[model samples]
Every structure is written in structure tokens, then in C-alpha cells.
Target: MSVSTLVPAAWWARLGQARRRTFLGYLFLSPWLVGLLAFTLFPILAVFGLGFMEYGIFGRPTWVGLENYRDILTNDRLFLTTLGNTLYFVALSVPLSTVIGFLLAVALNTRLIGQTLFRTAFYVPSIVPQVAAVLLFVWLFHPQIGLINFALDLLGLEGPNWLGRPQWAKPAIVIMGLWGVGGGMIIYLAGLQSIPQHLYEAAEIDGATEMRRFLMITIPLMTPTLFYNLIIGIIGSFQVFVTAYVATQGGPLNSTLFYVLYLYRYGFEEFRLGYASALAWILFLLVLALTVVVFRSSSSWVYYESGGER
Candidate 1:
């Protein structure tokens, strides 16, 4: 049968153009689709299945049902310990970094001498390689003959062993984490610059003080940036591994045993692939839940100029 006899001429003409564009689009996207399936999606599905089995590096996978998860929930002492450590790190580091980064951004936004130089100096630490930065801090946190302790001694005070004592180990890591706040600072600076200058001028003309202008105009406008930095900081802090791994190796009575480091021990060091997969899934759920909560709460605080309370 002829094609014109089977279909309407107008519909056939439209189909030809639409089909060509669709085909071209998918053809160009084929490489990315293939890579996603091969690399990202495949591993996630494999890990999800492995979490239910008794798999390891050398042996065939044995289906054990929920045994891996049951053990992790009930019999795993290190699981709770590492979870607590990670939460503690996040609680301390996220707020400190957000506040400090915002303040630095505000200060640097002013027209001051050597302003560019100061900004560069503060940001340099964030760009330094993670391992190298941690290694540098290890020396700085030394109990004896370290620059920090030397400065404290000059002020007629004793500096506690930062990375040595259990009480101080997590705090040391928190302080180390603060060194990279410059990344957040840059984001804040951009937000600050984008705020309209006329609003500040009107407030000044209306007899508003510096503090009032800051509280009324600056803070409300900056909330979106603050919210962004807060979310990123929380997620990054939860995944803290390289610093603790290189600096303390989850030492000082396991005070620095972050969740990712614990997962790494099981997956790579001990070769308990199934157990590690379970742990990985748990971590994924924890982070996902926290992120959802933060996003839900953000509508109350985060402000957007185009659409308020977005």
C-alpha cells in the first residue's frame, strides 16, 4: 500500500520534521547516555544488590537477605561511634564555617587598602590540595615546638594537645575544616555585590545606623547565599575523610572516625564488600534525609529578590 493512502498528508509532513529533530537529539546524547549506564547507574544498581548478599573480594556472592543490615543496626558498635563523630563534626563545622565565611565576605566587600590581596590570602588555603593542607595542619597542631602552641606560650598560656587528646581531636578537625571557608566566602561576596546599592543609600538617608542597615537590608538579601553555603557545608562535613584519614587515622580513641572513613575500612581495607555496601546505603539515606529537611525548611528563611521566600 502507498504511504499517502495509509496516513494523512499533513500528519506525515509534521512527523518527518519532528522525528528528524528527535533522532538527532538522541544521537548526540548517545555518548552521555552510554557513559551514565556504564559508569554511574550500573555501579549504583550493583551496590544496591550487593547490600543484600554476603559478597567479598575473592568469593562468589552468597545471598544472605537482610543479615548485613541486621548486623549493622544491632551488633555494630563502631557504626554508632562513627555516626556520632560525623554528626558532631557537621554540627560544629557547618555553623562556624557559614558565619565566618559570611563575615569575611562582608568585610572584604568594603573598599579598603589591599582588599584584593587580603581576599587572595584568605582564599589560597581553600585551593590547596586537601592532603597537603591536612599534613600542614598536623605539624601546626603539634603539642611541642608548633607555631600555635608557641603563640599561646607567648601569651602566657598553655595549649592543649590538639590532635592527641580525645576531647580535643574532633575540635582540632573542626578547626582544620575552617581553613577552607574561602570558597563559601566568594559565593557570599557575589551575593553581596548583587544587592542594589540604592537600598543602602535610602536607608542611610532615612537616619538608619550601620547595624540597622545590616540587619534590615543586608541580612534579608543575603539569606539565599547563606542558605546555599549552609547546605553545602553540611554535606561536605558529613563526608569528611581525607583530613581525618591522613591526620589522625580515626585515632585518639576513635574520636575522629568519620562515617566515610569507617566505610572505607570495610570496603577496601577489610574487603567486606557486602557489609560496606550496606554502610554506603545507610550513609546515602542519612545524607538524603538531611538534605530534604534543609530544603523544606529553607522556604521560611531563604529569600529571593525575584520571588521572595523561594
Candidate 2:
């Protein structure tokens, strides 16, 4: 008998239902496991290694030790500029999106006519292709005859060149970000619906007004969903690229030069692959740190149905 044949029959036979199920489940998940290893895990490690080198993509990488990181930390004016811009965007966008989304969810939760139509209208912009949405916004924000500017014109007010001016450009991007707030609104709506109706009824019987019920019950219960959207919004805000890439190209005195856009320019445009890799690693670390901090803080605010720890 072959050595392979002699080894495993008894072991196979000894496997119980739970082990078999686990094995089968892993078999079903093998494709994703392979992808994670090959595409994500391997590339991440490669980029981390590249962060310590001077690679220009066309030639062999030369060891740079910590120079790239030191430059980024101390000397790279554009890096600091982009980092500040990204932080500003994240700080502005995440809270605004969360509050606006929650309010929309609350408004839609009431029994109203054309509710389905309203929800659909709100959600459609989010599903629009990113390139298409950016292009549309470019036209809509056009200084001369765009719809938004035209509306302003009717009010005897002039619209600033949205993509051209420094002061207005980042805010324009944030306003564009709000157009997709419906995605978070839907999540909030689900959380609102899942809330036990009896709690509200009981509160009403105890003479709780609508405002009091919303404050006392709805806000506390919805904290988990709010926390979720807040983290996602912050992460997504940091990675803001498409609008800056397509609409502004990080222009108007680099007013909209976001972190990712700067990284992309280094990697692709300037061909400073090593510096770009370092930038990418920095971004990953920043996001991971922020996520960890948020997770830690969540114990203070987030609610879980299973317990009352918070």
C-alpha cells in the first residue's frame, strides 16, 4: 500500500459531525481564503517592505532605511498639507453625515404618504456610479450655468466657482459627500424599525411625549447603529479620492489635495513608488489607530440588546 493510503482512514472515520461541518465550511470558503492570502495579505506585506526602500517602479529598489519616513514626518510640505486637508474633511463629513442621515431616517419612520417614493429618491444617488456621480456634480457645480448656480442667480446671489476656488472647493466636496447620505439613512432606518414597539407604547402610557420618547428611548437604542455609521463615515472620508481626482484633481492651490490623492500622485504620476508605499502604510496605520480608538470609546456610548453594561 502507498504511504499516503496507510495514514488517514481511521482519522477520517473518527471525525465527528461537527468536525465534518467545519471542514466543509472551510472548503466552501477556500476561494476567499486564497484571495485574501494572494491579493490582500501578500500585497500588504510587500508594501510594508517597500516602505523602507527607494523604488521608482522602473528599477530595482534601493534601501533607504528610515529616510522616506523621516522626510514625510519632517520635510514633506505636501504630505502635511494633504494630511491636514484629509483630517478637516473627515472631521466635517462624518458628523454631518451621521446627524443628517439619522434625521432623515427619523423623518421617514413616521407614517407618511409617498414614503417609498421618498426613500427611493434618496437612495438612488448613492447607487449611482462614482465616476458618473462626480461628472454630474461637476456639471451641477459649474460656475456659469449649473443648476445650483442658476438657483443662486434667481436669488440674486452668485455662486463661487466650486471647483476653481480654494476656500469653496473642500466644502463643495463635503456637500457632494452628503448626496450619498442615504446609504447611512437606510441603516439607521433598519435600526429604528428593529426597535421594540412595546417600549415606545409603554413610554406613551407613562405620559412620555414624542420628543421625550425619541430622546430617552430612540437615541439610546440607536447608538450602536450610529456608532457603526460614524466609524465607516470617518474611514470613508479619509479615503476621499474620486471627487478630488475627477472634479478637482487636487487643484486650486492644492486646497483639495487629499491624502489619497497625494499618495496616488506619488505612486502613479511621480513614480515615487517607495514614498507612495510609505504613505499607504501611514494611511493604513492612521485608519487602524482611529478605528481602535473608536472601538475603545464605544463602550461609553454603544448599546447592545443583550446587556446593560453601558
Candidate 3:
């Protein structure tokens, strides 16, 4: 074959291969692109647009300028309360869940009889339907005839009415929040598996006890996973609406009025789309700012297996 003929054939083959690879990549990405436009990107832009107008269901939107933002910042009393409540939930629940999940992961990571069974049991609560789980918790934490109260009574202690007091509302939510530590535990477990076994053996050979080995070797190495769970827990807790909506209805004198729950109330009940849109943007900014701070601080602590660049 002539050199020109050979070169043309090779070039055509390479071009066809490249086209096939590109087609497959787009095929895999199309669903995500569609979802972004339909569910996330479009809605977010629509909300942003809504924030600048006076939107009522029955009334045409009039350009209201920055009135919604002004009201959220300077006027709304429930806005402040719900924001405070949500912040409080994030502060308490995130740390509580992280610590609990970490401890559980460490404990279960040990080789023991029925280890798989124990892991499965711990994880089952995580997959339970939200409504069913909350209902179960309601029954379990009932002031009377509840398993919690019953157990306390058996221990010769009086369990305070968990759902009845404003002082106890946040604590109750925090406690219930710990029930799904299974998800964080699973993440930690994967991180634990990634950690080389030689690290523990080396620490032990140096006369380090189990606790010391874990603190020095495991915990430090697990910082990336720890940071991940911490951030997710904080974000999820900040948007806490389901439990408060179902359990308290933002009740006990509005002690459990979460920010997102209040956002829902404004948007759906009051038809204050413009105000809700502003609140959503405020939340997005707050989360973005906090996440930036977390990423900034991660350089001081989070240890990644990728040699810390990640």
C-alpha cells in the first residue's frame, strides 16, 4: 500500500474511535445534565428571579426591588428565631452525630464474633423510612408509656418530658439526630478500611495501647472522612425541617421552628414567594461561607491519602 493510502486509513480509524468515546461520555452524562436543568439549575435561577419581585399566587408580580431582603434582615421576628433555632441545631447535632458515628465505627471495625451482624443492625436504622422512623421515635420517647421513660423508671430516674418543654426541644432533636449515625459510621468504616493495617501494628510494636494507636494513627488518618461527615452533618442539620415538622410542628412555643420549616411556611402558607426566595439565597450564602471556612481550615488538619492536595 502507498504511504498516503496507509496514513489516510489510520487517521480515519483514530477519528472514528474518538467519536465513539465522546458519544459514550455524553450518553453517561445526559441524565445528570437533564436533572441539573430540570430540578436544580432552573429552579435556583427561577427563585433568584422571584426574589426581585412581589409574587403572589393570584396577583401578577410587580418589581418590588430589595424589599424582601430588607424585611428578612431587619423586620421579621420569626426569621430571626428560626435562623437561631436552625443554627443551634447545626451546632449541637453535627458534633454529636460525628462523635457518635466515629466511636461506633471504631468499635465495629474491631474483629469480633458476630461483627457483620452487629454492623448490619447498626445500619438498619439509616435505611428506615423517615416517616416510619419518626413515628417510632415518637412512641419510644413518649412522656408516658414510652420505652425511654420506662427504661429511666427501671433505673430509678425520672425522665423529663422530652417533647413538652421548650428547654428540651433542641436536645430531643439532637438526640433523635444521633439515630442515623449509621450513615456517617459507614463512611468512617470505608476510610478505616483504606488505612493500612501496618500503621496499627507498627504503633503496637512501639508499646502504644489500643486507644493511643487509634488516636495517633487512625484518627489523624481519618480526618478527611471526619471533615466530610462534619460538613454534611452541618448542612443537613441547618436545613432540619422533617423531624421538627413531624415531631414538634415548630412547637413548644416555637422552640423547634427550623429555618427551612419557616421558609416552607412563608412560601406555601403565606404565598410569600419573593420572601422565601430571599431566605433561600441567604441560606445558600451562609452555607457557602461556612463551607469556604471549613475548606480553609482543612489545610491545617484534614489528612488525605492523595498526599493532602485533595
Which candidate do you rate higher for lDDT, 1 or 2?
2
lDDT of predicted model 2 = 0.92
The digit string of per-residue lDDT tens for model 2 on 229-257 reads: 88888888999999999999999999999
Error of 2 at 159 (Å): 1.3
Off by over 4 Å in 1: 1-15, 308-310
Residues 135-182, candidate 3, lDDT per residue (tens digit)? 888888899899998999999999888888898878888777788889
List clashing residue pairs in candidate 2.
none
- Estimate the overall C-alpha local distance difference test score of candidate 3: 0.86
Candidate 2 clashes: the total is 0
- List the candidate 3 regions with Cα displacement exceeding 4 Å: 1-24
Each model's RMSD to truth, in Å? 4.9, 3.3, 4.9
* Candidate 1 residue-wise lDDT, 73-153, digit = tens: 999999999999999999999999998999999999999899999999889999999999999999999999888889999
Which of the numbered candidates is closest to the native, going by highest TM-score?
2
Clashes of each: 0, 0, 0
- lDDT, residue 161, model 3: 84
Give the alpha-carbon lDDT of every model. Answer: 0.91, 0.92, 0.86
